[model samples]
Target: MYILIRYAALSGKRTATLFPDTPVAVACSLLFKFVLNVFYGTIVVENEHYIPKNGEPVIVCSNHVNSLTDALLLVTSVSSKKRNFLRLTAKDSQFGRKTFSSWLIENAGTLPIQRRKEHGDQADNSTTMDKLLTALSEGDAICLFPEGMSRFHPTMAPLKTGVARIVSDVLTRNRDNPEFAVTLLTCSLTYVHRWSFRSDVLVSFNPPLKLTVKDTPSLISTPDKPVDFEAIKSLTTFMHAQLSSNTIDSPSWDLVRVAKTAARIYVPLGTRMRLGDWVRVVARFVEGLAKPVEGTGAGTGGEGVAIERQGMKRTAYQDQLNALGLKDDRIRQSITLSRIKILWRLFLRICQTCLFLAIAAPGLFLWVPVFATTTYKSEQLKRSGPVWDTHDEVAQTKLVYGLASGIFVWLTAIILTTPIFGLGLFFTIWFVPAWMWLTLRWTEDLIAAFRAAVALYRLLWVSKADLKRLRETREDLHGRVMNVATEVLGLPKDPEAEFLVVEGEEGDDQPSRWAKHQRGRTRGGWDSALRYFSIRRRRKRDWNETLRWFDATEFPKE
Candidate 1:
């Protein structure tokens, strides 16, 4: 144990000192990359070219959303062969804890800031500042969450002045050095479903902003006048403006949720919208609603009342569906299903579900403990903690506890199996984690397929009258939402026309030989399995195509 501790300390020191292209840094990056990839189903990095390649000081400023995940994402995503590791500033208490977390932080190249007086003194602050300046002077990349605290807010909090101060100090000290240059790069992290397992994350990096002596001359303070209040304030305001523009922020998530629901129906059925695009559309809609119209009293009072009424109506509709024993998927199918193909699709789904269930049995048993612990702990936290009181805290507890439980369970399994495996313990431990991850992914897919099948069955077998009513209600809701979207977003009357475009010619609709083979395959009695896999691939391809079209035509280039 003593030797292990000493080795950990040595490893931490090496990790801290290693350059980006070094074996240690490369290995750490790969480890973090794998972990993040497993944690998120999809991670889309926008404007990756914006990351500066040449050896020059760069500060990456991002909004704090997910606690440790935010920092990890930034570190792993920004890769460079010329530069060393991206240094980060973390709370001093994290380092002082003398636990596994401290070891992790030290190895991750985190510069600790004193938060509590008891944990860190004046000297510690000075030391941290000096280290930051030294790192900047050496042309290393530094990442800091200017908001200082990670919260579950839809928007960024008012940024603290620490980042601005660091920049100013670095500039002031390096003013005499002719080669001194630093750039501020703003990054935004948007999660489709933050707390949900296998959710998508979008990381966007804005163009780097270079600060010259001419930009903020007040930062050039003399020895007698060390504090440059004006420079600090100006720099902070500038950073906030740049960061906020890149980030999506709203006063209320409830309003945003309402807008998102309304926006969903505006798009074509089976068309998958990018999460980032959906967020921007909702934010813009809310902004338009909040604007004071000349003839109409449609500012805060009118818009707020409208959204509240819409929320209540949606609740009522959900309750009505619940009374009919229909869930979201069932309602969706009921609304979107074509009358002609419904029976055929339902038959196909039934066959597919049987095959899916047969394959999913092993995964179901393997991942049950993970799911049970996560669900139970999440519910417990929601009920007992402050997570229930505020939107910011809603998923925070669940994410924390869920991650802890997963690690603990995996470790426990490894330990228990070690006695039996003995010499093969290492291999068993490695295989188990991979198996667990696969089990989780399989279970999720299985559950989704089962739910879709059940929804189709409900549409066909039970409550035809209720299904018809639900479809009518959905139509009404869609019409209302379209009207609002048309007025606010200036969308064309036929929004589907805007999204759907011919790839080649109107007559070129025939499927290729490979496509036909994929559609009609029954080898090893897995025709249904093949079809399910094809559907998944098709959906992903369609979604990517939709995003590409939007980027090309709908959204303006940055």
Candidate 2:
């Protein structure tokens, strides 16, 4: 069921609230579920127990990545617990827009915060803070993105101080009452192929940081205390550190790629890691790569030179693998398989892919137009300007635009076919989504199986000399990665041991942890390198924009 249930305080009364148990709300909730589930193939929630089940108030602090969808996902994922409906804080500009989305957002109990940069002289969040304070006082869960704005980056931007100030305000008010307490929950969101439709999502909730007067001595001086600057700053720092622990906080996209490659190769043979576990291992690699090795001259440009050398090594290794028509996992796996077994696996994979292709053809026929339209729209927006070109805006357009297109397409189909199949058109509502969901699943399976088959086919054609040289290089790189992990980051020596360190429940089923790597290029060597550089240039620009909220001194000036 698609339910959009929320309760927030507005002028001392509950406004535009939808109770979870109401019939209309249930239907809406189901529709909501369908939309989210269709857009994302898998939604995994980790440390769900961190959400209070006893109906205590909570301030849900999350890292922003996917624009408006972040709050919606948090509500869907965490609202199941025994708490009052989760309220949200949205940008003031959204509430001011004369659009259906803005109307829907306001009615859904989202308070609007005025941002100084965006709102200029009109920026004033005092009213928003007052509403949030009132809601929390009435025992409601409040969700806000401390990053202030949404953007896609390997690491989180420096958080805004507003959330900490709110927390401090709440703590100060309840300082004298031992019975009163509020929970500060940190949620880390990770996506696989973030901008791609039907990709996987990981919503990880770290254990809640409880705020009780007994534990918070700094806020105990007075009941009517003004917002303490030092306390807010400290709390923001603490929250960032806590949230960082749960995220893959790589210094750059290049490091993220290298870390992922290392994790894929270092995984033990004959074992598959779940997405959550895979993320954990990748985070470990990122941490290692971003840190300086012992005896490296700290802050003397030596550390940067070392990191640059490692990045170059990673890029060269990837280029070599691309040239050989192989990936890190494939090269690691091909060694364990016999020639006959390889051929047999390839044959089976091809057969399976063909079966899926047949099953998915109908859905593909129906949905391809919608997909194409959304893709075209996304490209148009990207070329429009830097504002739309950021990863966040591109993804937001795909989802928002795709949702609108799907509805239009469905309604248009019903209108066109009603003459021939009057009542049958009604059934299309359920049938289309159900069949489209099935088709999408099979389509993914078909693509994966076909890629596996091709990789196996290419395996038999690789010369022994090239394969041997690639293996040696792979081993050398893997060793260097392990040294970083062990000596610098102080992770366990065994990569396998770190796999299951993530404490959380698994999703529907564990898919293979291997990510799609850049396909090998047999020709156009110079062209490939040039293309890579061009993409990097674009990404560097995107990264700089993503960190716009941070001070110039916080991160390297790019």
TM-score of each model, in listed order: 0.72, 0.79
Per lDDT, the best of the predicted structures is 2
Give the per-residue lDDT digits (tens) of candidate 2, residues 487-528: 555556665743432222222233223322111111133434
Poorest stretch of ten by lDDT in candidate 1? 1-10
Candidate 1 accuracy as lDDT:
0.57
Q: Residue 172 of model 1: what lDDT?
A: 86
Those runs of model 1 whose alpha carbons end farther than 4 Å from true positions after fitting are 1-29, 80-84, 96-103, 116-124, 177-179, 223-231, 269-271, 290-344, 372-384, 388-434, 460-473, 490-558
For residues 215-251, what per-residue lDDT tens digits would candidate 1 score against the true structure?
Answer: 5567766677676687688778877776665445655
Candidate 2's displacement at residue 538, Å, is 34
Model 1 CA lDDT for position 512: 25
lDDT of each: 0.57, 0.63
